[model samples]
Target: MSKKVLVVDDDPDVRSFVVTVLEENQYTPLVACDGVEGLEMIQKEKPDLVILDVLMPRGSGIRLYRHLKTDDALKAVPVIMFTGIALRSFLKSQKALEEFKGEKVPEPDIYLEKPVEPQELVDAIKKKI
Candidate 1:
């Protein structure tokens, strides 16, 4: 079976772009506009991976990540955060930043920045699986 990807983003263009890239690379893509819907899709579809965004009107990516961590069923699901904000910029302290490296966080197996390169996105997904 093909690996499925759930992509959550508020922007239509970003969602479209992600879906296109996933499809072009032969992965099935599911999209959601907000955290609520994205969570619902997760429950229903059980995708192989999730490509999450940092900024969404309904809820931030961190919010959704926190929620995912709370659920035992969802905790193992790999998420590749696609954020415009650089991870280093968000890391406050040197110690904390060093601790966060490759930790899957409200924890991810992998992380990626946007606008995501199609090949990079595909590589991340494959690596997660």
Candidate 2:
């Protein structure tokens, strides 16, 4: 069976682009508009990988990413931290510090900037799964 991937982003264009790419690559793409919804899908669908955006409404992607990293069951799922924000911002976010304390959360498997390159995104997904 084709591997499943969950894409969580608030922007419609970005989400659509990713979905199209995943479909073309023969991976099943599951989508969510926000982090909370993404988590729900992750728990229910248990996708092989996740593509997450940093800034979002409801629960932010960083928040959800941290949650997944800390959760025993979901920690192993590969996540690509796709964002328009600079890398330093992500490293400096309050959530980042809070989540990494005690038992540190694992860093995102990959980090992709906004306006993601189609081939690069595909390559990252391929490498992760």
Candidate 3:
């Protein structure tokens, strides 16, 4: 069976591009506009993997990542942080958040900065799933 990959991003163009790439590569693609809807879909669909963006409305991907990593039932699912934010900036913010919460979560299974190449995305999905 084709693997199901849930893509959570607020950008329509990004979502469309990712969906097309997944479809072309023979993976099933699911989409959610923001972290709130993404969380709902994640809980319901239990996708094989998640491709997430950093900033969004309703809830941020950082919050979603925290919830996923801390949840025993969901922690095993692989996540790819696909965002426009630089990795250095993201890690710095993540460290501050962890310090504030007094908890540490593992970094994403893969981190890809946008705009990502189609082959790179497919390779990441394959590696994770």
Name the candidate that leads on lDDT.
3
Candidate 1: segments with Cα more than 4 A from true spot: 89-106
Runs in model 2 deviating more than 4 A are 94-96, 99-103
Model 2 Cα RMSD, 1 decimal: 1.8
Candidates by TM-score, descending order? 3, 2, 1
Give a tens-digit lDDT track for model 2, residues 91-123.
777455775675566668898888768999999
Residue 118 of model 3, lDDT score: 97
Q: For model 3, state the Cα shift of residue 125 in Å.
A: 0.9
Estimate TM-scores for all models. Answer: 0.84, 0.93, 0.98
Of the two candidates 1 and 3, the one with more favorable lDDT, higher being better, is 3
Please provide, for model 1 over 1-129, each residue's C-alpha lDDT reduced to its tens digit, 9 standing for 90 to 100.
788999999989989999999889888999999888999999999998898987787877767876786689998888888878777754333236346653434446676877767888878888888
Q: Supply every candidate's count of residue pairs whose N, Cα or C atoms clash at under 3 angstroms.
A: 2, 0, 0
Q: What are the per-residue Cα lDDT tens digits for candidate 3 across 1-129?
A: 999999999999999999999999988999999999999999999999999999998899999999999999999999999999999999999999999999999988899999878999999998987
Instruction: Report the alpha-carbon TM-score of model 3 versus the true structure.
Output: 0.98
* Per-model CA lDDT versus the true structure: 0.81, 0.91, 0.95
After superposition, the stretches of candidate 3 with alpha carbons farther than 4 Å from their true spots are none
